[model samples]
Target: CDYELIKLRSVSLEALGENEPGASISRCNTLRCYPAKVPELIQNCCDYLEKNALQTVGLFRVGVSKKRLKELKDQVNLNRSLTFDVSTNAHDIAGLIKEFLRELPEPLLTRDLCSPFLNIPSS
Candidate 1:
């Protein structure tokens, strides 16, 4: 085995919500427009499903920068709620839900539960 010193370089992950112009919006936007907290973001998603039922076919995707995710994670860890100017950062509620899911460190469902969850009856 050859012992050679090699240098490692750090590269940033791709920015969220940038590839597509209208596909996703900023987390700040959604927080301001819907006036939601980290926890409330999930509730809003539930409400949307309840209100729209199966009729909700179209929905915009949500995206947030890694920096924003870190900020949100910090706030959530510290039990702080997000706050921003509504007029300036108004965003889609659906998008915020998507962002929340995306930023989670682990999948919503555990590996063991995944099988049963997927097996749930559609009816």
Candidate 2:
């Protein structure tokens, strides 16, 4: 039998918190200025990484379990609150953040801004 394919759904950051009055201050195809300003998944992952994984070498280069990563992605796509406990692997969260960006319907850096970002000089 053939393996069943799973079609992952990309979360629309702009559409988040739209149902709540005054929740969104502004909306764009790429990003949203909602009450929180950033998507919950991105904020949580960054917070976790800053608090726990800042010193971990190769934070983003390291790989995590595919199954676990998929589970995490599913949780975020389902809009479930994520709790990263001490037992959670930082690599998984880092990978999740990368996956989230990669899966966006539009690139975080839109085509118009790509050149400007690419032109930024290195230190």
Candidate 3:
């Protein structure tokens, strides 16, 4: 399996505006492993969706501008949820297509492998 693991950690530290010891507030994030073929499939799928399904797909469908999303986080409510929703939307779109390629009334084997992004022990 050609696997990749991308770990992202976000830490927020309260402003030490006055006489305060430095401390960090952090949330550790772990996303599930996915097949490595996903990004290309997604770009292709997005092309179709953007042309036809943008409105129906909602905010998560196409993706938000990173700049806008960041600004919203600093200035709006439901910011965190929006960020995650956008990510989830991208994953969901890719996942469903993968499933479709795997089986339907008929079945097709895309590859013989475990999840590509899985963390496996090495000898």
The numbered model that scores best in lDDT is 2
Estimate the Cα RMSD of every predicted model relative to the unseen true structure: 15.7, 6.5, 16.3
lDDT of each: 0.40, 0.64, 0.33
lDDT of 2: 0.64
Question: Can you tell me which runs of candidate 1 are displaced by over 4 Å?
Answer: 1-59, 62-79, 88-96
Ranking by lDDT: 2, 1, 3
lDDT of 1 by residue, 1-109 (tens): 1101000001111112122343224433333223233334455445655655435445543344545545544543354344433321222444545655645544558
Q: State model 1's lDDT.
A: 0.40
Which one is best on TM-score? 2
* lDDT, model 3, position 86: 38
User: In candidate 3, which residue ranges exceed 4 Å CA deviation?
Assistant: 1-38, 57-123
Candidate 1 has a TM-score of 0.35
* Candidate 2 least-lDDT 10 residues: 1-10
User: Per-residue lDDT of 5-119 in model 3, one digit per residue for the tens?
Assistant: 1111111111211212432222211221123322333344565556555666444444545554334334222322222233344434434444334333223332334455244
